[model samples]
Target: MSNLFTLSSKLAAQLDQELMGPKVGFTLQQLMELAGFSVAQAVQKEYAIDDLNKNKKVLVIAGPGNNGGDGLVCARHLKLFGYNPVVYYPKRSSRTEFYGQLVKQLDFFNIPILEESDDWLQYLKPEQTICIIDAIFGFSFKSPMREPFGKIVDEVSKIDNTIPVVAVDVPSGWDVDEGPTSETYITPSLLVSLTVPKPCSKHIDTAKTSHYVGGRFIPNHFAEKYGFKTFKYQSTEQVMKL
Candidate 1:
């Protein structure tokens, strides 16, 4: 497979700003909706509902950031697309208006929203889940994961590799540009890089991991402004494998 442009964390943040600013004028809610939908499509494409065995559950471990919101939206869509998804969002963000709306929507779907608990591992076990969505961190995350996430990543590392872990954006505990610095970093089976892949995309083991680019909402003007190399998506698909 070919590669796409690798964006630094700074450039990524600036792109987000431009996308939301007056020129592009996209609301955060709108972007998140599209991103989450794209992610759901990718997941569905790779792990089809008909192919799943007796277990058809997806475990989405969401953080407290916009990535978490994307995960929430993804879980909701996955439910509509015929998969049971359970969300483990321990620390909800202070952006109550937006995140609360996501929660309300999940409630409407009757998806299980799990909080931080001692028994979190019960759901993380390979036999318990068909797939694991790691929506904990993004490119903005720095080294040394804090609080429950550090502990959570440790658990993720120990799970059986038979169950695929699909990381959203960047894998948790990995440096955005430098890639995995620690030995214990979680190795995702598949990575769904939103908008554009980060510089650390090169660090992932291509032979062992599958990477795809989602979030096809980037405007042409901004792409030109950043000198982003044009890449083709198959037909009308929102995501393209890289």
Candidate 2:
């Protein structure tokens, strides 16, 4: 796709609302699967490019919303593809049953669910080839810095290693419209913007990082209706670099 649209947080939220509600006819489960699969495709691309250690593990840091659900789903797919993925999901919203379903699926796969109190440093090894999937936040996040999440983002920033991070949508702690508040934000090595990227993606320095647009489930009519700028994701490809 040569042309792409940059969506404000409000517009992104609207699209999600329409799709998840009765009008769009896409359920939380379906959307989660599409997102998870798209992320899996991106991860495979990274693993090949970096020659990451097969024996080394993947860590998925997930938040409390559907963003976290996407991470949970990603972990399951990674495991099925023969990569060990550990989840660090600290919270869950009571309003959505999808979160519970995601948890159950991860449990069925026997993937490890890291407790919030666990020391994350123990999982880090400077020389080891590790990849972190930051699914900690999405379009719904607001900022001023909260408790454990703030601490968690701090921890991620402190990791002084080449362990490439793949952010699912918007990077955690980043503003969808305002971009990053500081350079200390979680700058991922690979960013997979689901369906269409949010406005914050414009802040990403393409010279130093790889950005991609995935999530192939958006219908053409919806794209036209929403005025999404175009891209050409051929049938053989699931993602396109930005």
Candidate 3:
């Protein structure tokens, strides 16, 4: 019942302060890993009904940001758990070093990366129940989706209603700081919010309108000093305690 929007300004200020220094002590890679681990933990707990893992297929829609890095990590972990996750990345340039590293990791894992011209939609059968992981965009995405990304979003939206979607952070195309735009977006069945709950989570029109799975809010100090904070919402255990 906590209102995350009320703390947005404060959180934004803290984030700015943490990034103003010469080097980001806590690299985005570390955050992406933590986010991925947190989501894997949450999904394992929530979807443990009658050995459902045996037949489930996971589809990850990743972009070129830290958000996509998180999805790659999730795909790796999911594969280790005996699930094959088909990862789809739109043709785009990446700005984060962590994202580039994740792309390599995905390749190492032999995870198929779908391109815009691949006709990947044909693989997703209407009756083939799967979980779609939306990591296409995050809080920093401000511009309206265009071209291949827009086309990808449109294709994924056609997935059957029986298929559940797990969105990483905010849903793809939904603005985190602001509310939802008229642009295309995915309405995930569950949203695993990393670090802290995004402001859009509170908006009724946002894509994260269903169940929310909260992740740890790792303070910069944790990365700088390898010290844990006293905050109760910084880890999966802490979130479960809530």
Candidate 4:
């Protein structure tokens, strides 16, 4: 597995652009749906609905970008899988047509969507929350996080040891290729890499972190075009544990 190519931040963005371009013609919604669904599948694989007799309440911390959109979709599927998921979406995307629909689906499912407030921390109870999905940032993220997200990352770091946090793509506040560059960065117990494993993944402490790769939408020719090896996912699986 060490021989597998880990994409740098630039390459990761370029690959995404290529996927969404006319060559592949895949829409952002399509990719987000698959990526989010794959993440939910990874969650089910790691934390079963009845695992260890713990409660099924999951706290999903969503950002305002595409990664957050993935979280929104993930929460919807988690509910369908019978897990009680509550979303903490402080900032939302302005693309109402897309994000609005995702939000509507969550509302239709009767899932709780918590917005930013002075006492937002009250919703994040480690004892009551079985798992926390870190969807606050992705590979496109850079250093020096902004306002509430910076504070949010700090709080999540404090509770990292108490709750099992599953980071979507790159961990929040981490340098896309250099790994953790700040004290506010979160080290999630499990990481679900989308498309390809980012170069920063080399810094992951394999002994402490359970890594999984999802987003099985890359075509074989695309990998050849990019000169990266395609991962071999198990039969009919959307995600594979590494």
Candidate numbers, best lDDT first, in rank order: 4, 1, 2, 3
Query: Candidate 2: which stretches are off by over 4 Å?
Result: 1-4, 49-52, 182-184
Q: Estimate each model's TM-score.
A: 0.94, 0.91, 0.77, 0.95
Total clashing pairs for each candidate? 0, 2, 0, 0
lDDT of 1 at 66: 86
TM-score-wise, the better of 1 and 4 is 4
- Better model by TM-score, 2 or 3? 2
lDDT of 4 by residue, 150-184 (tens): 99999989888888899999999888888998768
TM-score of 4: 0.95
User: Model 1, range 31-132, lDDT digits (tens) per residue?
Assistant: 899888888888888888665444568989899998888999999999988888989999988766999989989999999888887366777766678888
Residues 101-146, candidate 2: write the lDDT tens digits. 7888899999988868775555555454368888988877777767
In model 2, state the lDDT of residue 137. Answer: 82
In model 1, the runs with Cα more than 4 Å from the true position are: 1-4, 51-54
Better candidate by lDDT, 1 or 2 = 1
As a TM-score, model 2 comes out at 0.91
Better of 1 and 4 by lDDT: 4
* TM-score for predicted model 3 compared with the true structure: 0.77
What would the per-residue lDDT of candidate 3 be over residues 1-242, giving only the tens digit for each residue? 34442235346446635744456566556666767877666655555424644665677777777677778888887777667678887654466565667777878988777876665675456344357788887777776786677877777766624567777877777777665673677777777766556666666434434544444645557433422233355433623311
After best superposition, candidate 1 residue 125: deviation in angstroms? 2.5
